[model samples]
Target: MCRLFSLTSRDPVSPMLAINALNVMKEGHDGSGVGLCLRGLGGPFGEMKEAPILSGIFTEAGLKRLSQVSADIGLDPKYSMTFTPKTPPPPGTPKRGTYLARAFDIPDAWKGLAPEELAREYTRFRLMLRTTGEEQGDMQVFSFWPDTLMVKEVGDPMEVAAYLGLDNKDLVARQILAQGRQNTNYAINLYACHPFFIQGVCSMTNGENTAFIPIREYLASRGVDGYCGYQSDSEVFAHILHYTVNRLGLDLEYYKHVITPLTNEELDGHPDRENLVRLKQACRKLVIDGPNCVIGCLPDGSMFMCQDRKKLRPGVVGGKPGVFAFSSEICGLNAAIPDRDTSKDFQPMHLDTAIVRPDCQEVTICSQLQALPHLH
Candidate 1:
């Protein structure tokens, strides 16, 4: 199993805060890898929210190739943050070339496109770079979107953060998600790290995905451009979310229903049963099986957590008014926000999805057995 930690705040916080929280739950996950995704960025990036930021690891050759490709696509470089470790990586950690998070200006030729069209173009550009890097084994792109940055490395979470200079003031953000992987299911490939991102949706999961192959085939058949990579089974969780809410135009609440639908008997007598039945039938292939707990962030900066039908994995949501954290263990929560009201901390059940809006004010628990309240 992996350890998951996510935080959303009204003010920007360092990614190291999330990394430290993951360390408190070190017993749950072996120190095999660390993955982080930061959204609603602050610091230098706050002024460049309109530009798309490409976050990845690159070789010297890969960097040159990336520049050529971006120019070919008419994307102009705006600003960039490149980190080179001051010292060699610690023992057991692989040595890498350069870490980059470069922002690009949307070319004048594509500035008039609609929002959806523009988003599709970003995905295309990212995938093209990914494919080019794959053939040469020189690049590993994690995310390409505005106000977001991602980093994934194979090592202990805390060590990786310090080694990558993640404590830099400019790397702060209002929301961050971190995962400490145990390396139980797949080989230690950097692309298979947690906290996966596509477009504006990002998610990390703990526990095995028993229904991965079927779900992968279903998602791939949708003819989506960014749905090809399946280096990790948990990747489908994020894609399923993108399909349900972004592509299908469904509300965020329906995402839980699509992945862990209530049974026919459980759905009986519910006010929205008709629609729920239709959703369940139509999205049956997307239903997930196995012990898992998922924490995800949407494009709007909202964060959420849900459990499998059996509630096999552990998770908790707790904090004060200005900041909230979703962690795999309560101890992790206490480590991140120690002053929170302990009584208000919530542990979601099989039928519950605990959500904290971008405001970070309160957590709303929506249940599968009842009609969901209108959430905006």
Candidate 2:
């Protein structure tokens, strides 16, 4: 199992805090890789929230190609932060080229486009860069979205964090999702790292996805450009989320129903039973059969965690009024927010979904058994 750590605070914090939390649960995950997703950015990025930021690594040649592509696509460079490792990478960690998170102005032609249309353009642009990099073997793009940044590398969590200079104040964000990968199901590919992102949705899981292929096929058939990559089985979780809330125009709570639907007996006499039944039938292919615990963040900085119907994996959510963490282990929560009241900490079970909105003030535990307010 991989160790997952996610934190959202009213104020921006360094990624090191999440990395340190992952270190506390080090025993659960092999030192194979680490993946981080930081949103609700602060510092320099805080002011540039309107610009889409591209996060990834690039070689010298790749960097030139990226610039050329940006010009061809009409995206103007606004700002950039590049890291050239100050010291040699630790053992088992491959030497990489420049690590970057650069923000770009939307093309003038796209300025008048609708929000959804612009989002589609961003997805297409990011995929083009990813494909170019993959074919040329020079670039590896993780995310290209506003107010979001992703970093993934192969090595121990702490070591990778240091090598990438993640402690820098400029990299601070109000919300962060970090995973200590175990690499039990697949090889250590950077794209396979956890905390997968598409458009504005991001998610990471702590257990094997037994229903990956069916879910992947269903998502790919939707003809969505951003749903094509399935390097990691867990990537489907994020796509499923995007499809549920963005594509279908459903409420956020519907995502839980789509992924882990209740049986007819369980839904019997429920307030939305008829709608639930139709939803279950229509989205059956998207249902996940898991021993999985999924933690994710939406476009609005809302953080959530849900367990499989069987509750086969462990997860906990706890913190103070201004900050909260969703972790695979309580020790991780302790490490990230020690002063919180342990008595209020929640361990969501099979039918529960723990959510923390952008304010980061409190955790709302919504059950499948209860009718939840519609959330976009």
Candidate 3:
């Protein structure tokens, strides 16, 4: 199993808090890798929310490739910033050639497109870069979204943070999702790390995803331009959220229903029984079957955590309005939000979904998908 930590705050905060939390629960994860994704960026990126930011690692050769591709595609970056560790990575740690966070100006031709269309374009561009980088095995692209940065490395969580200069750097954001991966089923591949992102949605998981094959096949069949990568079974969670909201135009709550729909016996008591029955019948392939706990963030800054119907995985959701935490263990939350009222912390059941939005007073628990609330 892996350890997942996330925070949604009204103010800018560093991910060190989350890393510290993960360290306390170190026993739960093997620390094969660490994945971090931040939205509602603060500090240098806070004011550049309107511009698209590209976050990744690039070699000297990779830099030239990026510039050539961007210019060739008419998506030149307006400004770029790179972060390297103040000190070298701990001995034996895997290091990146050059860590970067760049902001790009949307080309005039694409500026007129709708937000969803523009997002798809950016997704295509990111995938193109990934394809190019594969030939060299040096460049690794995490995310290319507006006001968001994603960085992942194969090493101990704390050591990886230091390698990225996470503590000494000016990296800050209103929301962050971090994971310490314990490689149980797969090789130590960087792309297989958690805290996966697609377009504006981000997600990280704490348990195995046994239903990955069917889920991957179902998603690939949809022909979504950005749904091809299956480096991690958990990546599908982020894509599922994107497909539910962007492709189906459904409310976020429906995401819960699609991924963990109620059994026919349970649905018999639902108020929206007819519609839900139709939904389950149509999208049953998307249902995930396994002992899993997932934490995710949406474009609107809403953060959430959910568990499989079996409830085999452990999780805790706590904190007050301005801040709430979703972590794999109580000690993780205590480390992340020591001052918050943890006495009211609750563990979600198979039937519940926990959500927290910026400035929200409390974590909203939705017991049934039909009653799920919307942040907007």
TM-score of each: 0.98, 0.98, 0.95
C-alpha displacement of 254 in model 1, angstroms? 1.0
Error of 1 at 57 (Å): 0.4
Per-residue lDDT of model 3, residues 1-376, tens digit only: 7899999888888889888988999999887778889999888778778888988889989988888888877787877778777676775466568888898887888989998789889988888888778778858888889989888887789887777778745688889899987455776666778888988888888777889999999999998888986877888999999988878777767888989998888888778887788878988999998788989999989999988888999999998778888999999998888888767898989988888866657887787645444423
For each candidate, what is the lDDT?
0.90, 0.90, 0.84
Residue pairs in steric clash, candidate 1? none
Worst 10 residues of 3 by lDDT: 367-376
Candidate 2 structure quality by residue, lDDT tens digits, 62-124: 999999999888899999998668899977789988999999998889999999999999999
lDDT: the better of candidates 1 and 3 = 1
Worst 10 residues of 1 by lDDT: 367-376
Clashing pairs in 2: none
**Position 218, candidate 2: lDDT:** 91
Model 2's number of clashes is 0
Q: What C-alpha lDDT, on a 0 to 100 scale, does residue 71 get in candidate 1?
A: 91
TM-score, candidate number 2: 0.98
RMSD of 1: 1.3
RMSD of 3: 1.9
Q: Cα RMSD (Å) per model?
A: 1.3, 1.2, 1.9
Model 2 superposed RMSD (Cα)? 1.2
